[model samples]
Target chain A: MPLIKEGVLAEDNWQSLADEDNLVDGPIVVSLERWQEERESLLARNTPLGLRLRSDQSPALVVDDLERFSVVALEFPKFADGRAYSYARLLRDRYGFKGEVRAVGHVFRDQFLLMQRCGFDAFEVADPAAVEAWEQAVSEISVTYQPGADARRPALALRRSRPAVA
Target chain B: MYRYDEFDHTLVSERVHQFRDQVERRLAGELTEDQFKPLRLMNGLYLQLHAYMLRVAVPYGTLSSTQMRKLAFVARRYDKGYGHFTTRQNIQFNWPKLEETPDILAELAEVEMHAIQTSGNCIRNTTSDQFAGAAADEIEDPRVYCEIIRQWSTLHPEFTFLPRKFKIAVTGADHDRAAVRVHDIGLQMCRNEAGEVGFEVIVGGGLGRTPVIGQTIREFLPKQHLLSYLEAILRVYNQLGRRDNLYKARIKILVRSEGIESFSRMVEEEWSHIKDSALQLPLDEIARIENYFAAPRYEHLDDNVREFEVKRFEDREFASWVRTNVTAHKQPGYAVATISLKPVGKPPGDASAWQMDAVADLAESYSFSEIRVTHEQNLVLAHVKKADLYALWLGLRDLELATPNAGLLSDMIACPGLDYCNLANARSIPVAQRISERFSDLERQHDIGALKIKISGCINACGHHHVGHIGLLGVDKKGEEFYQITLGGSADENTAIGKIVGPAFSYDDVVGAVEDIVDTYLEYRTDGEEFNDTYRRVGLAPFKEKLYAAH
Candidate 1:
């Protein structure tokens, strides 16, 4: 599996740990349940920590520990479940989480642009061959109509073309 | 009536190119059907029973003669030379290759139209009163806000993939022509004691499976706070709305379960944070959108036109149409003329390419080149003058658009059932055609007076069966088509869900059952009471007795 960060394939150093499993040394990602249980113990160690959040989990859980984690992975249970997109926006816009926001599980080329617009800088997809497709998808629509976590200007920024009043 | 600006044009063209790539990838087996389904849905292309159905959004139901001509062109070029107008004020083409959709969308964008968000779970085409800018009782044109919402919701990053489809309807008048009460989010334009225009925000009203009327979260949201308030509602729903159960995922169920008070508090708290942010609509932007919908030039003719009066007296057919279809417009000389798509013994809301071209020509000549699509699946020439009524009537008559049955017995609302939609359990078009043939006489329909017979093939209620005066839900009973009848539903200011009658009737007996109900209404009604009013006045007893006795 390859991780696409900022529209390019990147080397991933973080390894995710299951909720019931013990946390290993080195850069590691953990689920919300494991983070809640092992927050102090993980903080005492010196490895970079990441949090894997399901769509159902709120970002407010890591409000104080946003600095402790270098990566925050939002889980898309399915492509159709869009709750994680809002979670990404909340992490970036509301909480001002400067760490790398990654999208994991059920992500693909079609959603790369939307996921990026919602401030997910890293996407962990199963297919390594989809990097080119993802690069094209992210830039397919240069113009946008809505403002999100990204800085793209809305179409309404153009002057209103109303008829001249006599 | 809005021509696309540079940014608008750019976005649509970009979408076309994007969809083309997606389709190419799909054909090459890079993307499976499961992956392509949502991608296709966002572009308003659907895999139906037979072929791909492309629904083009008619924004706020308003169209120019140019847009109308383009629709007719698409029908002739890509589809079966005809298109079906939907209850959401949209036009749908039934047959097109999945590969042809991008080209179809490109052509639509040439006319300032696109299929974006027409079928997705995202905020759908914002519907408004068909008579929005022309209606007499309107406080403000709802299309201004509708356009604002349209721009704000397009490709919205967060809310695009919700648990269920969301529909929003806005109405400027006191009478709910847009059926605001039954939508996912209903915006009613009203004035407060201070004489400032605002909205009465209603949340969580829907009809599929669990039908519930919306609860008012905001009593009066000022014009500027509209976007902020709506965003708050969406954010709350996105975080809290159930994704586990497809049936209970609508905002209505959320508002219903959490209690309106609790839901309102949550929305208010969310809104408090973002009220002053960039989402709050600026005054100039509001005025800019408002200016697009400003009143068109008008002629200063008197209200009474002797020529129109003479034609009505001389021609009974035209006069019958005037009685059922024509309504008073705000301007002195102009009148709103409803061209019924539901004629006797034809598929409702269907207009051929030639008929569409003829309508466009008529619009150019008579209605200042503007047309409207209504929630009742009818078209309206909203600014027709009194002097041009006869000429327009003759033009429509020649084109088979003069169906004198608007709001009458034969003017029924029906969904594309088993004939097209894959989700349907029974055929709705044949049933509607049979009923129309049963009451083919124009005079008989006029006598029945303003009865809405809404029929849906399945309980999705696309035909708005839950809101019809005589609602019919088509169900499959042991591999046979059986229709369950409901009585006294109205999707007006006084919105009420229809009650299910005694039992389900077979396909053959459904029409007779409706006839029995109408007969009962005719027998016991007061002098001027419509079917809905009469049914409300005298419960469902007489109709139930009459319908069940014959069975």
Candidate 2:
């Protein structure tokens, strides 16, 4: 699967370590359980480390490990679940985690902008082939009213760009 | 009414195209009804029993003459020659074909309107006091903040997919015309010790199956911090509100279970981080929006209009109408006139194409080109010159819009009920019509004075039956429609969920039961107190005994 980093297609660097998979030399992403068990040795690894958080898990749990990990991948268990959106914001704004916040599963073109607004710098979508089209969703609305972690100007700044039609 | 800026125009215009594409894909069989249901609801299109019902948001019940004319055009073109104004201050067209909705929305967008977020699990349209700006007693205009909330809640990335639907109502005056207590998040504008305008924020009040009066979570939230505070409350609910049981998923239920103390703490903790963030409303921007809602210029005239006094003295019928329908306006020579949608035998809150066009013309000519739809299912001309009240009444009489009942027995709020709603278990419209017809005599209705008869077809309480002074909730038991009556409920400052009096009445006896309850009030009254006041003073024992005697 292809990953989106900073609005462009990128090869997925961090691989999730499954039950039977062995670790390689490159950076690795592991489940919350795996990270909890191997926190000492995983931090000791030369490669960059990351954690994959499930929908039920809070980003507050990773507060102490903010500097320990380079990425925090939040999982969307299903389409209706929005807990991950909050987690991404919490990680980016609350904990001051200046790391890659990736949206892992069940990502779609429709919610691409929503994910981006919630501070997901990286996206490992269900279908990577649709990345180019998903990139266009960010510009669907030229202006936004809410403040988010995404690098878009607030509506006030953009108000002058499009004058009122008197 | 607020004019749409270029940004707003572009936003709504682009949304029409998005909906058009979505509808085209659904028609092309690329998307199933299951996949398109939520998407369609986000745009306020509901699949009703007879056809597609399109609910268009009348934000805070304010509409310009242009928008009103456009609505009339839409009603004539797409619907069955009429539109139903709803309790949430929206208008629902009962017979728009699914294929024509995109075109309908496109037409609506031309007049700075759309059906966006009118229905769905998202933060629905922010409602406020219908007489927000013109009300004599208002501290500040609530629409300014309501518009702010509308912009922020539109396509809100995080709060869109909440556990259940959320509603927010605001009142700018001391009197609670907006029914702020029965909303998910109710903001009552107030002044602090230092004379700063702010909101007395309440959380978790709702009417459906588990009706609960909202509790105040914050005594005073500063005006500038409105968005940040709302964001905090929503964030807390999104994380903790129940998703397992749809029945118990509303913010009211969450507030009830979590307790107000704990909920307040959580919201405060969240607000601590985002208080002065980008969501903090800039003072200039707030003023910019406020400038749109400034009071219109008024002519210098005496408080007592000699013509109105003379007309009141000479014409008994006109005097009766004026006594009930006319309310004081802030300006000395002006009055706020309510045009009741409920007539003797018509469906409540419904307006025909002719009626809509006439209203637009009337508003343009007499009321600063602004009309308001009241939660009580009536239209208000907010700034009419008292001297012209007679002419306005004559004009309204021609359109059959002059139903002199603002808070009388026949002035009822009822849902479309089984006539259109797929979720309704009984017919509310026919029941309302029957009650209105039962007590159709104008003199008798006036003598009875100020009774709220709200009937909901089902437990969803779309009719606001829970807060009606004479509340009636229609139920279906073994396929027979039965009505449950509750006494002493109000949406005013003293907000309380009505208590079910006794066993339900059969549809045949429902009107008679209501009559019996009203008779009970008349018999026990010392003075001519309103039905709600009488009920509260005397208690439900007498009313209950009369209602359930034959049951």
Query: Top model by lDDT, which number?
Result: 1
Which whole-number lDDT from 0 to 100 does residue B188 have in model 1? 99
Question: What are the per-model DockQ values?
Answer: 0.78, 0.58
iRMSD, model 1, in Å: 1.1
lDDT of 1 at B144: 92
On TM-score, the candidate that comes out on top is 1
Q: Give the per-residue lDDT digits (tens) of candidate 1, residues A1-166.
A: 7998877899989989897666677999998888888788888888898999988998977788788889999998899999988888888888899999998999888888888888999999988877878768888888776667888766655453445556
TM-score of chain B of each: 0.99, 0.99
In the range B1-551, model 2's lDDT, one tens digit per residue, is: 68887778888988888889779879999678987888899899999887888999999899999999999999999988999998889999989998999999999999999998998888999888888887889999999989989888987878777888999999999999999999999999999999999999999999998889999999999989999999999988988888778899999998988899999999999999999888888787899899989998889889988999999999987899998999998889999999999999999998999899999999999999999989888999999999999999999999998889988999999988888887888899999999989999988899898889999999988888889998889899999999888888899889989988888898999999999998898898777688888888989899878776755
Model 2 stretches with alpha carbons more than 4 Å out: A6-9, A17-26, A44-46, A127-129, A160-166
Model 1 over residues B420-475: C-alpha lDDT tens digits?
98899888999999999989988788888889999999988888899999999999
Q: What class would a CAPRI assessor give candidate 1's docking?
A: medium
Give the Å shift of residue B13 in candidate 2. Answer: 1.2
Worst 10 residues of 1 chain B by lDDT: B1-10
